[model samples]
Target: MPRFSANLGFLWKDIALPDAIRAAKRAGFEAVECHWPYDFSTDSVNQALNDTGLPMVGINTRLGINGIDDLGVCAMPGREAEAKGYIDEAIAYAVAIGCRNINAVAGKTGSTDEAEAVYRRNLAYACAEAAKHDKTIVIEPLSHRAAPGYHLSNVEKGLETIKAVGVANLKLMFDVFHVQVMQGDLIERLRATLPHIGHIQIAAVPDRGEPDQGEVNYPDLLAALDDMGWDGYVGAEYHPRGTMEQGLGWLKAYQ
Candidate 1:
């Protein structure tokens, strides 16, 4: 059976960071990941992880004043320095917490040529930083409609960027929800692009809710992963339209 983990950044938005960790433990998750532990101190986050004995699967870099809901690092022009700083912080945090993956958002959209150049340069730098700590940096592609003009909003484009960078530590963060929205053929695409995939995130299509609430048949998806021998974690990166506990039922059933 596939191991289960939760993205507390989305699931427990209403509670404190430490409380979110507690809730994930209560929900029977063996591991957890988060966008940014903004609400809690590093010591507090460390304490929760230590107490729960739940490994942190991943953690996102800080977005600074833009915050996670607005936009983040990859969008700003001439912010390569700032972006590097953010990535460095995440690398340090991941090393401290024993995390293996770090998800890097490409911010908002930029001009095609400009975005491409910036993304490649920034990711190359970020990948080098992550490699120092033996962690992988996965670049996520949001749906085009959701992030218009953004470079890296589709798997094809993301793969191109990764190839351009040619950094071994850099790979794609394949989120099923975004891919289902922007590009169809999840399984085939996953197989074709398996070499570039470093991490995976799952959510129901349309609703971005529980896996069972939408059109995705996760059993088959998991089976595909098994066939491919995917070694990374399948991050539960979804929002619960209802209660958090209700959302966990699908994962429980999946296991």
Candidate 2:
């Protein structure tokens, strides 16, 4: 069976981190991922993971002051040094917490080609840092509406940027929600970019809710992944439109 990991960052926002772990465990998840365990200490995170015996499948870099609201790493100009620091910190945290994947945000939009080139250079530097710790940096392509003038808004563009970086540690994170919103033909895209895909995230297409509640037929998607022989985790990275437990009914049916 394909492993299912809950994204605590979105699911259990109201509960404490430890409680979130217990909740996920009770909900029948084998692993969990989060945006950043900012409010909790590394020891706290480790304790929860150890207690539940759930692998920390993935993590994100610090989003600066605003957290998830202002999720951009490559958007800012001349802040490559700052971005590198964040990536380094995330890498250290992931290593300390036994995580193998780290999601990197391609900040906001840039002006000229020269500016975009700088962003790519920064990504390469960050990827090199992550590679040192055996952690892969998955670049997420957000919808153009969410990230205006964003450098990597689609799978093709994201793959192109990864190629430009030319770093082995850099790979693509195919978020089905964002991809569905930004571009259609999900299965075909996944098949075409199978070689470059390093991580996957999913949610309902229009609402970012449960998989069963959305337009995407997840069983078909999962079957496709199985056919492709994908070995990575598919993170549940969506906001629950109702009670978290109610939203997770789809997972129960997976088995």
Task: Give one digit per residue, the lDDT tens place, for model 2 in 1-255.
Answer: 567888988988899877898888989988898887767877888999999999988888877555455465654666677778888888888988898888877565553576568668877777788778888888888886656666567888788788888888888989899899899899999999988888888898888888886689889988999998988788888888889867777898996
Write one digit per residue (lDDT tens) for candidate 1, span 1-255: 567678987888798877888888888887888988755677888899899998888888776566644367654667887888888888888887788888777776554677668877878888888888889988888886666645567899888888888989888888999998998799999999999998888988888887886778788988898899897778888879898876677867765
C-alpha lDDT of residue 202 in model 2: 89
Once model 2 is optimally superposed onto the true structure by TM-score, how far is the C-alpha of residue 137 displaced, in angstroms? 0.8
User: Any idea how many clashes model 2 has?
Assistant: 4
Candidate 1 lDDT score at position 77: 67
Lowest-scoring 10 consecutive residues by lDDT in candidate 2?
A: 66-75
Off by over 4 Å in 2: 65-70, 110-112
Cα-based lDDT at residue 208, candidate 2:
84
Off by over 4 Å in 1: 68-70
